[model samples]
Target: MSQGKRTSQGKRTSRGIRTSQGIRGGLLRRHRDFRLLWCGETAGKFGASVSGVAMPLVAVSTLHASTFEVGLLSAAAWAPWLIIGLPVGAWVDRLRRRPIMLTAAAVSLVLFAGVPVAARFDRLSIELLLAVALLTGTAAVFFQTAYSAYLPSILEPADQPEGNAKLHGSASAAQIAGLGSGGLIAQMAGAVNGMFAHASTFLVSLLCLAGIRHREPRAAMTGPRSSSLVGEVREGLRLIAHDRWLRTLTLFGAASNLALMGYQSIQVVFLVRTVGLAPGPVGALIAATGAGGVAGAFAARRVAVRIGTARATLLFELGLSVFALLIPLTVGGAGVLLFVVGGFCVSAGVVAGNIIKASFQQRYCPPELLGRLTASTAFLSYGTIPLGALLGGALGTALGIRTAMAITTAGIPLAALILFFSPIRRCRDLPTSRRPTPDSTRPPAPDGEPALPRP
Candidate 1:
């Protein structure tokens, strides 16, 4: 072959390689709609994190709320998942998700801003705080349900893991920033003023959402509408109950959340009253611990690829949770490192596990049923959060704060037992597709009983 001809072929190959690499650049850079969505979601997460610290601080410092009341405050934020989760899912399936998300964001902005307004009027009572939390939480429920279903429409099946990882990673980073900022803002001006920061983020999110170019196609109505809301909800529940993989993950998630929320509900009180930390330090410490989530998010895709998703789930969710016991051992000065380390592990584990779960659901479930699937599973998993918060508050009241922390932390690792006893333990990778059940099959292994056979 002629040397010039060989060189020309090499140049063609090199140009092809360059084009491929350019296409493979970060999802945020390559996809405009997804980037907008990511920005909106991350901004919203930052706001929530700020309020997570500020709201409780307001209750403790300004309103002089008791320990149980603080726990109830936390519970109020998650209680909507129990009350309206099912109906919300069915509704999301039927509607254009972006509008629902926009409305929810608008509602949240008003609600958070109302806090400082009420404070200015000398009407900032614990009762009012609870109402704000409750209302914001309700908005969150709608936003989240719609958001989950809408995501698949924007990204291809292959790109989902990267998308989930980027979203989760940025969210973790935003949480760290927000938590730290919440403390400083509280110390400098006051906790009440921090709500302004929280409210402002939603405005950013709203603008980002508005900037997105892609519009989801309206959900197609097929045939005569035979299913009532209740019937649709039951279909979602039945899907989870019948699918062993879904059932295992959902059960484990519920158990894990219970334990997680249990300790988290009283962490502010423990740090303030027991660990002898100021409000600023409390937020900073929590922010520091959240760095683990950032690590988890960055590592999730690689870890899953290296170890398989199912095994990665166990390692992330179960193995890493063992460090949670260290949080209860925290004290003044250098002993605070114990809490940091423990919280880091727990955060990393949860985030990584979530990435795996999110990718799985987007890939495994039918697009039409994704909304219901997300809602039903979340209803069970997140529903336990309020119960856990109340339990933590009750335990802290009955036992010492330290004792309550220890008890709750123990449950974190123990909750993984739900995974161990189910089908997840026997497989390496979680199945990418669920097997179809015949239309005539009996309603799956009634609720709690395992349904699908081992992969």
Candidate 2:
């Protein structure tokens, strides 16, 4: 390799970079496996979001489900996470993960499709709807748990941030489409049509799962075959509990998610009832919030590279805390100028938090326990969102909507304080030059996965 040749090759690489950016789709070309998984999972997530709104909307508008039953519907999705997440993680460690993921996806499609069919026949009972939601969620937990375990297995260590950003981007885009399409279908197709729309989304997801061509490494270790499930679960817990840093990050993530949901729960209602926006504009305003999230997803890796992921997280969180605190005082404009700015800040904060957490978990946790770690962590992180929603709703009813909005702002400060006390806060931003090294005592990443440093 002469210097002239080396310089020529470097120039060509730079040209490739410019070409990819012009298209704004580098991850797909850069990492093929990740792209397939992301694309295949689309139907699953798209359908999930559609029914996420449709089922509850059905419960409320058609069945006149009380606040309690709607609460029940929401509860069904997360209950498994809290009750069975750790146990399930342990169980997953004992089995081949790919089959579990595929099966769960297939089952979820059927469960989601059934809701619409029952409704079209004019038999959408509250119990039936709730039952469908529960079963669908049950399948979703397995699908999701399996996927998280599957991630570190597939991605190169250097690729996880970009891979994760791709996943987040796809999910955000899917939800944007799902929610918007769901509303239109419900309006024009009647409530029954909404159910059909939900069903089609699920069917599409089923097809995507069929196209995924990758498999996990078979020799993948799973402790002794004779090990008890309970023992495995406890082992997973012990790993996190003993690690001062992991425990701190876990607690911080869980608390942040709860506060996020608390604010969201009250936001639209407060906008409609208190901010004086119509229902039509109110919903669009919420979608604007999603757009903020999409922007954040796009910005995640670049910002992490620039400021380092840790400091960027603090900057984003603190910025949002200030924004959340100001909500009560500032939401008076007729158009979306205020809400748009606030929503973008809040959503960007969430994207940064999630990206940091994902990168941290991938870097630190060994492959064998990844399942347990993710499930246990999700049990708290995802579980808290709904509780926050419930609490925020109650606060709005009791303290008046404006006051509830103001109080929920406390969650931002609370999350920052929690992080401040945690050791992870002191650690330099992840995705920096400190590359991940295999902790030989801990398990390897999936498939003899090699560890490499990200930029």
Candidate 3:
């Protein structure tokens, strides 16, 4: 694949620009913009990892929140996906992604910084924490929706897999490092100070984004003028509902996320109360799970190439998710290994699956519909997160954390059945190109998968 000349918005305007003219021949070796993007994401992800630990610690330690309230905190953070996701997708298609990203980062930076300020004034409460989580989550919804559609314009199709691998790998590494450091920060300076650390990462990300020189195409600026928001959103929904592959993946993602978040919602409380772990140790253990994600990121391409992407996906989704059942069996000695092993497998599997699927979608879907496609799918997938959190909290409050964890963790493997019964199960590799079918309800192709639907 060839590199292109950049516009002012960090997007490539023409495909004729050459990277091999000087010492820039190697892939991503000389891609200045991509390198900056990678750095920014790594920094941002690190901050998120720290906040992941600090947020719960503050709830459990300082506020003395109930197990159900912790779960509610988790729910509040993700509720925006259900509420504003569809409209945001429509808006993202109409606006330049970089500006949206910048605005989201700035907002998140301010909001997170406010937590510590509130704490110092003796004014922090569960309501304030929940509100901060909800607002930050809303910003994330916009930023993430925009970023998914933005990546394709910055790199050639052939370079995307490698780019994704690098970005995912670095992000996992950041998470691992951040988790350990975050725990230490919580133990030393208190959880409120960790918010200050989280706030700093956003500043780093914003600066990196500001340094990018390419400009996006004018099409993004004016293309949606002819269409209404409802019309555009409907088109996105239609694409997901009609396409068999997308339909299957979206369903599987939703179910899987439901189970994943269910367990994650109460994992900290379980480890602290049931497993008898301290805050610092809890952070270290969570970081250990992220080590698996790092491995998964680096291993994703190799596994896909060796076994075929389709088969590898099942192994990751089904085979690895089974280990999640071990989590609730932990006793406090060498038995802690059960929780570590189970969480690691699940984390690895999910991250690897995401890498493969993201690359597939980028290759298979039309560029114009990418934003809507991402939003529509996430609307269902991440939409389940709040529900899962609520379910987990309710179950924990009623049946006890261990039993609730067991029931939820078991659902992870069960979620894979959606894919196992779909066309994805019979294939070795997912389709790379879209084929026009005479009708949406037509039979599967000779290859065993249905034709890709068009927007």
Q: What local distance difference test score does each model get?
A: 0.86, 0.63, 0.84
Clashing pairs in 2: 43-205, 310-429
lDDT of 3 by residue, 43-131 (tens): 99999999999998999999999999999999999999999999898888877888899999999999999999999999999999999
User: Model 2, 79-174: lDDT tens per residue?
Assistant: 667667777787676666778877887677677667767776877798887677667677777888877777767665555667778787777777
Q: What is the alpha-carbon lDDT for the whole of candidate 2? A: 0.63
Q: Model 1, 92-161: lDDT tens per residue?
A: 8888888999999999999999999999999889999999999999999999998898887777665677
Give residue 119's lDDT in candidate 1 (0 to 100).
Answer: 95
Top lDDT model: 1
Q: What TM-score, over all chains together, does every model reach? A: 0.91, 0.81, 0.91
Sorted by lDDT (best first), the order is: 1, 3, 2
What range of 10 consecutive residues in model 1 has the weakest lDDT sum? Answer: 1-10
* Residue 37, candidate 2: C-alpha displacement in angstroms: 1.0
Off by over 4 Å in 3: 1-28, 221-226, 436-455
RMSD (Cα, Å) of model 3:
5.0
Clashing pairs in 3: 7-214, 7-215, 8-214, 8-215, 9-214, 9-215, 10-214, 10-215
